[model samples]
Target: MKNRILSIDVLRGITICLMIVVNTPGSWSYVYAPLKHSEWHGCTPTDLVFPSFLFVVGLSMSISLKKLNRDNHRKIRNKLLKRGAVIFLIGLLLNWFPFYQTNIADLRIFGVLQRIALAFMLAGIVITLIQNTRSLILSLIALLLTHWSLLYFLGGTTPYDLESNISGTIDIWLLGSNHVYSGFGIPFDPEGLLGTLSSAAQVILGYLIGKNTLKHGKPGTKELNHLAVVSLSLIAVSLVWNFVYPINKPLWTGSYTLYTSGIITGFWAILIWVIDIGKKEKWTLPFKVFGQNPLASYVLSIIVVKLFIYVFKINGTTLYGWSFKHLFQRIFENHLASFMYALAFTFIIWLFAFWLYKKGKVIKI
Candidate 1:
């Protein structure tokens, strides 16, 4: 408990809150531009949400994997494997929820949680194997470069093309067209397997930051200055890389990974300065509640939304539709109404999270 970082928890909570808002808009058709993910290339506020969550996942791992060493590495690896498997299973189950929406054979095989699971497990194992920070940095660079090489060399003329990108090609080859996501007007899963290379890099970056933070006890002015320099450097390099590689969130490009990781690190550094140092903890209560049980809160939000969309109805309209039509849409513009519904939905989930926090419960995944 002494080593627990409030800033990390608050950051996790912020990410989850935004994840719900962007994900469950009253109508996907009416989302604001910032709320929508970039169609193919470039980054958006929505694009940052998932990667930010993954970055936080990496930070948490810094603490969790600190005990790994030659003596107990085997046991630790097995435990990480189990945890990652369970998380992946949860993501799979989420995709297959209600079981009637899609044919079992054609169900999506990868999603946000699946990506998180893979990134965490893969990054955890890498960190375990390479305990030294210098080696971990080398591994992170290698992961990014390798992902870039594979996509550039094998992805045809338009390497980062949505339809022709090597990442999607790999997904289709491994998971089959029917088993992949078809949202991009093609069977391409953005959270596909190949993207995990860079995703793991994102986690490793977080781990490196966390490891450094823990090593120094708690962050201070010196740590903040160092973090700011490193974060800005990553952003600068990513921007330069974008000229050639392009910053594609769907592709989960190496540039995108670096950009998001840098942005998240800077943001976390600010949080540490404000919350951890300035002692401003009162406003963080709601987010702390959300952060403490992030996985459970996220899963519950998904299920609750599903119930509204898939099960409950009002006068022949799905509950989600009915509520949006009556509660918010009737008063506000379509876009604002859509956003309002998402906000209200998030608040509902927050209530559930707050109750858990009040009960002194943390539902570990």
Candidate 2:
């Protein structure tokens, strides 16, 4: 039990680390290919980061929600609502942070943390209602298929087209173009309402895996073999489905969910093998710290970056740009310099995380 939990913490920490690195490049234009999200279709390492965090969220839920019983339903419901709302509100505030710089009415309505909050709440409710593994599996299947059908049937000829897809259309209609993400050169949000269906399914998959791990007792060689088989099966099925539906991150396609969850599950299995079975845990401290306080670390990193970009200035340039150009860009090629800046920034956050760990602080939110 101890080793299994440690592996989860490490997985979460790794995800948070990569998220900070990818999101804090010196210049978006100069980022390496792997760190950048795919143009539209297909997935990248960066694309997997967010879903991996959600997968961890689900895995954590499996442990936390295990205490749920009929008598505690009301208490759990209130707890879920309160936590979900708080997380969603924080994401919203982050979107509009440095309030003077943001137009109040035009802020993006959905984002990474918001998606996590929603998926967590939805998955919690589903898990509570369906304790049976078979029923939960069926629920997961229904979510994926329902999302796919909506996109293909409701979307016109070009179902997966960036501009015309059903998801984007719905987002624009409901949230208004001004309030939706314009990153895709359209009023589309990757974390929009329609995508939540698949996102919830992703969480349920993680929960199911975690529940299975608990049911089978402590992870060992036999458990590792089972995870490998399941992970490979998910990967194979997703690859085949990719030909038809295409694995898209922005759309949060079913194939993308399956592919990412499979990859993360396989990684988790490796962690258990190394940290538990082999007892090779000497290098796990940093990740364990990160895992212990992920929410605080992630939120702090974003707030600090926002301050650098929006509030601080150096010789007529934002502090972020000035530091990147003067310190990093001057030392190396554009892409490498950009990457170096991200690495340094990630290190700063890691230091903060380490301090919190040393002080025995684990920010629960």
Candidate 3:
């Protein structure tokens, strides 16, 4: 609590809340446009949530890495591997949770936590190895540009088109058909292996921002002005890049990374100005609670949703069963019920987190 940055926690909390909102929409067919991810080669608000989470991961890494004064590189490496593996396994388990599905061979292997774990490990290793801001920046640029080049050149004639893309091809070959997403009628996952390279860069960028901000503590008007300048520059670059590459989440396009990173940076600047500089904490308490115990809140929400759908079996129907989800569908008799049900579920989870916070219980990895 003492070393925590209120603004960072608030950002993380807001992201988690939005993740639940976008993820648990009453019905996929009726979701608002912004809540749905882009079909293939464009972005929706939902597309930003995962990258924003990755950015925040980088921010948290900055803090953690800064505090590690020990020179035990081996120990740090082991810790990163262990933690990353654990987080990735949790995500995988959640994907195959209850572990009783007959289609076990076709279960998804990569997901949100898996992406986070991979990104965190890669970014941590990079930060550990580079040890210089300028070099880190160069590395990020190199990674992004290299990815773009590889996708463009190696992908050959039908670049950016979903069916023939190298990224998807590699994923299928490596992860196998059963382990990849068939939602698009092919074996592809948005969080697939190649896409994760850019994701790691996203986290690295966050680490850079956090490290700089902490170094320039008690950000004055001058620091705020500098942030504004950087944000604007990034937006301008992102806009240009979007024209060339397009903002795509499934592909994890370079433009999408820049665009989302710019937005998050701008968002961070505004929050810092308003809350940290303006000294406003009262309005941020709810978010702070979730932020402080995000993993607990997220894992608990998933468990609760599963339990409600499985153990409770309201009216002999699964929570997500056509009948149960439809009960509210009939009550509200529209998309609104689905949305409200999801919101209520989210709120219940928040209340649980708040209760835990009240008891001074914070779960960590």
Candidate 4:
């Protein structure tokens, strides 16, 4: 059980590392196609990172819930709500960092951590209030199905189209185009309002998976086989679902959620089998460091990266650009150099994470 849980942490560590790598390319223009998100529909390696983190969050939540008493339902609910709000607010801080530099009304209202906080809180509430894997699973399906129906009916003729999707409309309607992400060359927040339903569903699925894992015996062939069977079943379902709705990370499409989470669940199953059952432990430290302080790592990575990206100039460019221009770009081709810069930046953050892990300073919320 201990080994299996450690494997979860390792998987989480791996996810955070990838998150850093994907988010911190030396130059967006130089990134490999795989490192970039899909233009509209379908999934990419980069797309998997956020969902994978949510999955790990679900698993972690399950483990944490075991420490709490369902008998103290009110207390548990309060703690979960407070934690979610704090994390969500922290994300808001990151979004608003270097504050007063930009208009407050024009600041982005939703972001990575905000989505995570909302999802975690909602999923935690559902799991706590219902207190059963079956109810969690049902709610997960209901959320996904509800999203599909909303997109199909309310999205006009081209419901899933990039520019015209209802999600972007809602962002403009509520937060306004100036306050939403302009990276798409349109006002679209990938982590938008209605998408929260599917995001929460991902966490709920993870919690149920974790709960089911505990109900089964310890980490062994039986658990592995069970996960494998479920993985295969879900892959089949997702593939079929894709034909009807398409798998899109931006919309948090139902098919995308199923396919990515299924594949990640299968991948983590192998990770557990190899690291836990196989008893291989040497290469696990760095990831454990990342997993130990995911929120701190996530928040710090964004804050520091944004600082490097925005402030401090050398040779008439941001420090990050200046570093890449002088260092990695000088040694490697554009694509590889861009990748190397991201990797180096990720490592720099990892060092701090390692320091925190060593000091037992895992920051929650």
- The number of the candidate with the highest TM-score is 1
Cα lDDT tens digits, model 3, 268-354, are: 888888888899889998898889888778877777767666566666667565543666677885567768777877898899889
What C-alpha lDDT values do all the predictions have? 0.91, 0.90, 0.82, 0.87
Candidate 1, pairs of clashing residues = none
TM-score of each: 0.98, 0.97, 0.94, 0.96
Question: Which prediction has the highest lDDT against the true structure?
Answer: 1
- After superposition, the stretches of candidate 1 with alpha carbons farther than 4 Å from their true spots are none
Write the residue-wise lDDT of candidate 2 on 1-365 in tens digits: 35348888899999999999999999998999999999999988899899999999888877877777778867887788789889999999999998998898999989989999888888777877776889999999999999999999999999998977999999888989999999877688999989989999999999889878866556788889989998999999999999999999999999999999999999999999998788888899989888999998899899999999999998889999999999998899999999999999999999999999999887886
* Candidate 4, pairs of clashing residues: none
Q: How accurate is candidate 3 locally (lDDT)?
A: 0.82
Give the per-residue lDDT of model 4 (tens digit) for 61-152: 77777755568877988899999999889988899887856679889989999999899888888888888667778889998999899888
Per-residue C-alpha lDDT of model 1 across residues 126-215, encoded as one tens digit per residue: 987888899999999999999999999998999999878888888888979999999989889999999999999999999898888766
Which TM-score value belongs to model 2? 0.97
Which order, best to worst by lDDT?
Answer: 1, 2, 4, 3
Residue 353, candidate 4: alpha-carbon lDDT: 96
lDDT of 4 at 361: 89
Give the count of colliding residue pairs in each prediction.
0, 0, 0, 0
